[model samples]
Target: MTQQDAQTKPLTVDAVMARSGVQFGTSGARGEVVAMTDQVCHAYTTGFLQHLAGLGEFSPGMRVAVAGDLRPSTPRIMAACAQAVRDLGGEPVFCGFVPTPALALYAFGQGIPSLMVTGSHIPADRNGIKFYRPKGEVLKEDEAGMRGQVIATDPALFDDAGMLKAEAPLPEVTEVARSYIQRYVDHFGPQALRGLTIGVYQHSAVGRDVLVEVVEALGGKAVALGRATQFIPVDTEAIRPEDVELAKGWAAEFGFDAIISTDGDSDRPLLADHTGEWLRGDILGVLCARALRAHAVVTPVSSNTVLERSGAFAETDRTRIGSPFVIAAMNAHLAKGEQPVVGYEANGGFLLGTKLGSLEPLPTRDAVLPVLTVIVASRPGKIRDLIEELPPRVTYSDRIQNFATEKSEAIFAKLLEGDKDAQIVRLNEHFGAIAGAVTQLDLTDGIRMTTEQGVIIHLRRSGNAPELRCYSESDTVEQAKAINEQALAIVRDKLA
Candidate 1:
């Protein structure tokens, strides 16, 4: 049957997956919203929470927190989820209009599990749910188990009337944002940010005002600009050159030291230095890892090699491209009595050092800590100075191709087969000798090949968007761009 016809039929978990293309990731679950309706959210959340309840993770009297971003449909989806949690014999606590990290912090602080409704910088129409437990982020295996239950059950078995049972109003939780702001204040001192003029572009960011508050708490002038009630669909992964130029003009006009903004839920950060040049998110991740003086850094293969070369980390572990993978690796290291000083993503969210009295690092992405790292690391000089002190490694990333929703994953799978397709063989040979070793292989998330030339090329599909992402790193910025261009040429010729 056609995809539309299948979707119109009664919604099964399998049907939802097939229709919406929902997939499990390091983050709880993600998929296109066109296939994710209120019914889909209700069914999957109810099934997953019920499964959790069955496992005794939460009892009937236990409370669960719910939060979401500024996306248009977030409220509806969140409501559906909250209702589902209540129906599963849990109390639903609604933390209205908070960033995903804040909600995760609240969940850890309250000693209750939580759920966040967000699409994390995807388009306005897209939305997904992320789950957190007291221990840390939910594991990918756990999510896969939940998905299995969801798909195995009959959609018609859900009690539509029973699911609508009324429950106590969502209780107001104390503002966790204040606590996060205070953490920065306590660590960096209130005067640490003095003399820095920071311009914050508040374009439909759920954490816009909170970011401004953090800036002010640090003793910096926080200028809020481009405040938009309408969704701007800002993608933190791929920023346009024009946006960088615009930020530069704004910094010059306002005499600002830096420009910073967050993705929709304020989980992923976007930053520009004093020169108004937007740094790649992976680069920001490296800088933050360095500032934290992490002994071991956990990041995805999509990250830059400079992370290892910075001399800031004794070891670096690469994982699939997602917060869940990074967080899982960090947790494993911590279990072995090793302190996980920092965990981050090519997207700009940095997980802080996990410790007591410190919030449980949310499995979801976070933008605040990364920006704070840059600000705090400035020390005696402005952020520009820190950038100057770092090695001149440049990384370029862009999503150059689009695929039909179903075909995207298939194309990536084909690339991983590594047959002697002329284009694939040529790229394999060219980049096989760079950096240190040539490994012609497929990692979990995508096709990543390392070379002895100190360059790495990664081609993968965006979990949260409809495009394919290509990442490359080199000694010079221009050279990085050139390599990315060549890689894109190969992808086009092959995927075409």
Candidate 2:
């Protein structure tokens, strides 16, 4: 086709996804950086705007906030997205290299749509674009809407490799960073963390410096450690072995009250206690909810059962594993006029669904809130003391990388072939040696089976990549790890 014809012809989001090998994952559009060319990124941004426009959340000449992580590809992707905003007759407000939540907060406060260029905890070679409506994250329906869009673009704007011929320079950084830091300082008070010594792990996370600022502003002596120049894919759910040792060393060396860090975009958090023991995300969620005095709590089914067993909240709900699902459940309670509703994930990303005294509800995964809350709530005693107060439930998770999704599906199909009794029999046959007889099964998001001995084992395929994840909960940490190891071994052997 001629250039003019190509410029006029519209492209469907699905078609672009197929052609470029970039598709929406659990949270956003993700793929290898090489697959996410300027043309592809532009098309996605345009499609997102088109979908939001239909919902009356976007319009021409309106401002759309944009931000990025510290990945090398992020700036280039952000430029493409910003150009698309201009092409769509909307103004692009570059929020600079800020955390995902900071960009969302700024856009929400201004009542404007926004986009973030990040891959979250993924590797640097891969990246993603997370869309946000004026209020919060786009839901499943919004994803459908974006996927169904047909976006028109000018072919002349891009080169043969789909890169922009002349990339538009990103605008000057807005005051988003300052405002985001102030959000915490103003809410928690300057003396909230008084008499505390905290270590902030600044390992190339986009919000590394921001984390330090928050800790110091809250009146804690902040020590920055292991600042990396390159991107480090730190998965909070499966804490890296090196990170675990580093935290232990830092705790012993610095005598820190607590050590805190975040994933690449700073949405998910990593918090280690004085003993260098990192708290699980679900446990952190429970502590944060208690600290905030939340009445209603929502989280993924993959999280520990301690929340329900602790009797801390008046109501609790579980959903499929993902922020969108947790946010949806939180919104459902809010629609019913539930007060002080909150949500979190198994990755330690806390979401506040209801407004507190001076802090507005963010309703997105946040690292700062939980980092501060858990630390403050642990005061008057060490973090270990807070753990002693909780129930005896412990949860552990691990995954098999490069595992085929088809194989995982086959396993699930075989296991879930018959009724509950038959399914239980199948599960027990596989895990009974380590976990005892399967007593109950919960398939909210994955296969969560409870044994006669009260051990819980859950298995699911990763939404973003070809992998099988296993989770286990038991009365002791050793038992949880053993159950997880046994489950992974069984799955691996079956695949073999």
Q: Which predicted model would earn the best lDDT? A: 2
Q: For model 1, how does the per-residue alpha-carbon lDDT over 361-450 read when each residue is reduced to its tens digit?
A: 444577887887787787667777877777878778877644554566766655546454544565555444344455454466777765
Q: After superposition, how far is residue 243 of candidate 1 from its true place, in Å?
A: 1.7
Q: Which regions in candidate 1 have their CA more than 4 angstroms from the true location?
A: 1-15, 150-174, 356-364, 418-444
Each prediction's TM-score versus the true structure: 0.87, 0.96
Clashing pairs counted in every model = 11, 0
Give the alpha-carbon lDDT of every model: 0.72, 0.90
TM-score: model 2 vs. ground truth: 0.96
Q: Which ten contiguous residues of candidate 2 have the minimum total lDDT?
A: 1-10
Q: What is the lDDT, from 0 to 100, of the residue 368 in candidate 2?
A: 95
Best by TM-score: 2
Which residue pairs show backbone clashes in model 2? Answer: none
Q: What would you estimate as the lDDT of candidate 2?
A: 0.90
Tens digit of per-residue lDDT, candidate 2, span 1-496? 2345445556788878888889888888988899999989999999999999999988999999999999999999999999999999999999999999999999999999999999988788889999999999999989999998987787788887889999598888787988889989989899999899999999989999999999989898999999999999898998889999999999999899999999999999999999889999999999999889989999999999999999989999999998999999999999999999999899999999988988998989999999898888887898888878899999999999878778899889988988988888887888788878889899988799988899899999888766799999999999899989989999998643
